[model samples]
Target chain A: MELDLSVEIAGLKLKNPVMNASGTYDPLRYESLVDPNLLGAVVLKSLTLNPREGNPPPRIVEVACGIVNSIGIQNEGVEEFIKVKVPLLRKFKEATFIASVAGLTPNEFAEVVEALEGVDIFKAYEINTSCPNLEKGGVNCALDERCIQQVTKAVRGKTNKPVIVKLAPDVTDIVAIAKVAVDAGADALTIANTYRALVVDLKSRKPILHNVTGGLSGPAIKPITLRLVYEVVKALDVPVIASGGITSANDALEYLLVGAKAVQIGTMNFVRHDIMIKIIEGIKKFMVDEGIKDIKEFIGTLRT
Target chain B: MKLVECSVTHNLRVRPEYHILGLECGELGSIEPGQFITVSVDSVEMVLRRPFSIYRVFENRGVIEIFFKVVGKGTKALSELKEGMAVSVLGPLGKGFPLYEGVTAVLLSRGVGLASLALLGDKLKGLKSRVVTIASFKGRDADLASDNEYVKSFSDEVIVLYDEDRSSDVENVRYLLNKVKPDVVYTCGSKRLVRLLKELPYEAYVAWEERMGCAVGACRSCAVRTVAGYKLTCYDGPVFNVRDLIL
Candidate 1:
């Protein structure tokens, strides 16, 4: 039986249920080793209103089962990204391109969407209101209901394409923020971003990263993020894309079984560049072993 | 960039503090001096692959080497690997040192940094350039085995400095560099080296080292401060012009 790995996210049909998390994989680097078209989707690094230099040296530190990183959303400005990246992105005709948008203010968020609206390359806009490493500090959009709604509404007003609002995982109540985004205009939700965490270098007697704290992602946070996806999926009717500590297809399967429409591979890409392909292959083998014909049938089939 | 599994030929303790991990693989095509490779540890605890400069790439022998200090569990685990074992490797990563032929070049290195420059010696021999290597060590134990052999193969002159004599200090290094008056300089190992090279007026290059999540530029884990702005050490360079870097 041929496995139908097709899955939907806010009306877009993806060939597979697997896609890369924002800012993790750059296709240009390993052009020969891997192909982006093999992925269901590709989310580019978060783009701000202007080009950012990102954080200082030592942007990442490895921990037990995970890594803490504060890249400070380093990127070419939206204008430059469209100019330089759009043509390159067009190479992946099969994979859907998602523009991960980040800005300091809601106005900045709206302007980014407005600028990218005319660009024919991007299939969707991922409003990244969830980054914890910004100067404003933790959970800026998570706690502030008005800020979430405002950013979502502003972005929603500008583009006809689907808007995925990635929520910060450091919040006290993530469901509440998801509600606000959904109510305002988010077509779907990327359940959570990396959890806010810190690590100190014992030899140096100081924080490992210059930002002092960063978002943590890896297999370590999988269970915690799984629960987050579970709660959000139970409450919300909209599509939920999971992005956290997913290392293997089994981890991805857990999120899919818990009702996530698709999965995003992040830090694990560092361990092996072909991890996404390994995962997609893993998922295929799993479906064949489990006698599952279509992925949508297996998705959200949790016994609980 | 390619991922290939190579058999471990040897993991010899080349020095008291350093071990040279030698792997036999067929043709890792056209590797430059400062270009590096990342080795997968295959342990759950150490999730990320550890990066090492291509200390030596011998196409005739089908072997590539990495000289590393066993500071943490990852290196410790790698040091324990026996010969004939298979290991996954991603290679010819990052930028290497400048490859201009027939130019007089001086390699200024400190501590384990010489490992990054070890390959350049062989490359320069082919280029027929006058190469001078001035290496400084804190003590006798920190010195590498190759330092003894560099003169016969690549360098015209080999000067070894030690921290105990204070001869390895900045002022002495400055004097040595001025005396050689080479066409270009290449360096690695410590920030103090970069600080010294930063002030010098001559043309110089640095093979920087940073903790990287991905050997590819995508992860942006290895950001090096540059005069132009911040650049990803994994992508933009592990090799950069001395003038280009802010540090």
Candidate 2:
């Protein structure tokens, strides 16, 4: 028997249950490796209002089974993304393009969303108020309810497309931020961004990353991410797109069992360019072997 | 962008700190010097790719060799790769050193940067240019002869400069440069020596290493702005004219 693969988060229906996490995979760079049309949705790297060169060197450090990135949201800004990236992404047939935006201020966020008004390819806008990879105002915008509500309200007022707030796992109470975002008119929630972490080279007596602080992702943070996804799914009424530490289809299934509507694959993309495909295939195979039908039937099926 | 698993043919310790990893490229030998291939160690343990320069690629043998130091977890994992173990590698990319016949001189390097000149010396040799392999390091044993033998076969002379401090190594390099003055100069590593060469009257080419993304010139992360404006180090050069650089 064939297993169903269609999934929906908020009002958006995805053909499959897998997505390329924001800032993890670049389609233009690795298009030849995999068929972009086969993807459920492609979340582009974080875009700011103005072009950013990002942080200094040694931006990434590989740990024991994980990776840390302080890329600082290095992007080509909305104007360039709209001019260059969006056009190329729109050419792909089946993949839904979700543009992820990061800004220094709420107004900048709204401005970028506003600028994206008429451009047709994007299915949604991911408001990244919490990126541990950056040093400044991006994460600060989601630390408190006031900032989260304000930024969400500002962007929500400007765009007709669905806006999903990507939250930080580093926050004290993620549910509080999720409540604020839901109340402020967010369409969905991407719970638990990379947690701020570090690694020191004992010989050099200094941190490995050039920024000193970086966002940790991969298998190392899987447990924490599941807890966050579970907590948010229990607290908020909005859909939660689980991310952080998702590597395989079983990992994605684990997230779904815990209450994630869908899952995002990050650092794993660097190693195997077609991991998304493998995960998608693996999820289908699991469903077939387990005698399950539609993938959505198992969504949040985990019992306490 | 096709991801294919290839087997490691040779996995041996070239030195105390370095490993010589050879993989079967099999009819895939268009890579240039300074251009690196990204390798994946394991699907679960190491997620991100570790980039390794092309130490040498033999088209007839269908072999691609990489020389890497055990610096961190990724390198540590790579060092443990046994012969016949399957590993994934993305291909020959980035702009290599320009091949010009009758080029005056060549300067080799120490460390993994020796991989940066794998194809360069061959190109210079084909051009019938005089070359010098100046082995600069902090008291490394002379018995470590993997690619050194390949370089020696192509160069005209050899100079060994051993100093721990990089600035001191630059001064020592100046002493040798004065002795082997030539019409043109090319270097793989040693930015300090490259800077020192800029102060001299002779024209020199210094290959600079930078953090890269995509390595195909799209990310624009490895751009180094010189007097001639910004140029992507990955595509435009891992090599650049010494006088053209601002620093």
Candidate 3:
């Protein structure tokens, strides 16, 4: 018998436990690679109030194990995304649309949420606290509880839609900052954004990335993301969306077993575009083989 | 997007010291100028595909020709390619340069930066552009790997410039600008020549080269900072208006 794949998080039931991560697979560009209709949901790149061209070149620096990127949230802003990207993305087959957003100020965050209102394609918002909080000392908003509460409250006040706070992994106590967001009325949380890192060229005697710093992702960060997911699950009663270094079906399964209601695929999709579909199908097969009828049955149920 | 193999029948060097490695891929079968191919050069050292512009494609003895220079790690790896060893390739990407259909007096290159104009010379010849192919040398004994035979085959009018030292390149550049006085100027690899031509009163397109991280416009690595904005050299152009770029 086929297994029931629906999994609920933040009052919405995902058709499956997997969603393409923000900033990884863009449906507008790779439409030919996959049937967007097959995806559970597609989280878009981080949007801001103003369009950003992103960082200068030498943006990518290859490391020993993986890669680092200083893309600086290059996006077409919320206005263009609604005008151009939404109508195209709405064509996806039963896929929920999650808008990932970044802003320098709390007001900036609210402005985009308010702008996106009435767009049926937008189901929820992921407040990217990982973005360099320009108002602060270039320290990410996720690093400070006060910044988290301010941005969360501003966004929550504007729209009744569920908000998922995407926290940066560069913080000292992520749980405290998460609790601050939860207290300020965020519906759920996505544990960990890309970790801050760097690489250098031996010949040039200079940093590899032009920006000198970038976010590191891939197989190297899986354990850290998983640990964060476990801690967030233990701390908060609300749902947790786990992301970072999820490259396989088992990786998704592990996130679910640890406590993530949904898993977002990031850099792995660039290397293998079909990894999302493979993971989704694999989850169903595991459920069938285990005689499990639904995805919730596996959430946080690690065999002791 | 046909992928064909080209063998290195001959590797010659010309004045201004540029490596002209020729591959007998096949009868490029109606190849145009400005088109490029992604060539794979693999070993224990590096593992990635390097894209090279089809410098010159010719049909002789039923074999196609693809030419390139030793510019980067990929090119270095390609240069080390044995005369008989086969290399994998993906080809003829993007639109090629427009061969002037009318009798247009285009300023041909006369220095080391002449690679950009090499293919254009052949294309212009086909369309029969006044074909003023002017080439020059850096200095005496500066003939990198001067092969007299290969030089005679390409140029319609080769202008050899003799400079004493470092400053002669600038004076030679001014002389060519005045002598050619052509309607349009096209350049390939030299930033110095492109910058020089930018001041001249002529429509020019400087062929740009940047390290392409992902060629399919995904990474946006090979972007040239133009006056308008950052345009992808791979997608938007491997060519741009001389005035549009900062050089």
Name the candidate that leads on lDDT. 1
Worst 10 residues of 3 chain A by lDDT: A58-67
**lDDT tens per residue, model 3, B1-247:** 4445556666555422255666767644565666666665641123335667666655555443444545566666666666766765555555566556655445344344455566677667566665554444456665321343333454455555455554348566667667777767676646767788787897777667775543445555555778977776755677677889975
Clash pairs for candidate 1: none
Q: Worst ten-residue run, lDDT, model 1 chain A?
A: A130-139
Regions of model 1 farther than 4 Å from truth: A131-139, B145-147, B150-152
Q: For candidate 3, what's the TM-score of chain A, rounded to 2 decimals?
A: 0.96
Error of 3 at A199 (Å): 2.9
Tens-place lDDT per residue, model 2, A1-304, is 8667988877788988789888767777677676777888888888888887776666777677777777767777889988887777776867788888878877788898888888777889999986332334344666767778878999999987889998888788888879889999999999778888898989899997778987888898999989999998888788999998887889999998888888898777776778899999999899998888998889988988
Ranking by DockQ: 1, 2, 3
lDDT of 2 at B113: 65
What TM-score does structure 3 among the candidates reach?
Answer: 0.74
What TM-score goes with each of the models?
Answer: 0.96, 0.90, 0.74
Q: Work out candidate 1's RMSD over C-alphas.
A: 1.8
Task: Residues B1-247, candidate 1: write the lDDT tens digits.
Answer: 7888999999989786689899997777878889999998973567889989988777899899898999998899899999999988998788788787898888888888888887897788789888888888898778663455743477787888889989899999999999988888899897888888879887888899888888788978899888888888888889998888886
For all candidates in order, the CA lDDT equals 0.86, 0.77, 0.71
TM-score of chain A of each: 0.96, 0.95, 0.96
Better-scoring candidate (lDDT), 1 or 3: 1
TM-score of chain B of each: 0.96, 0.86, 0.79
Docking class of 2: acceptable
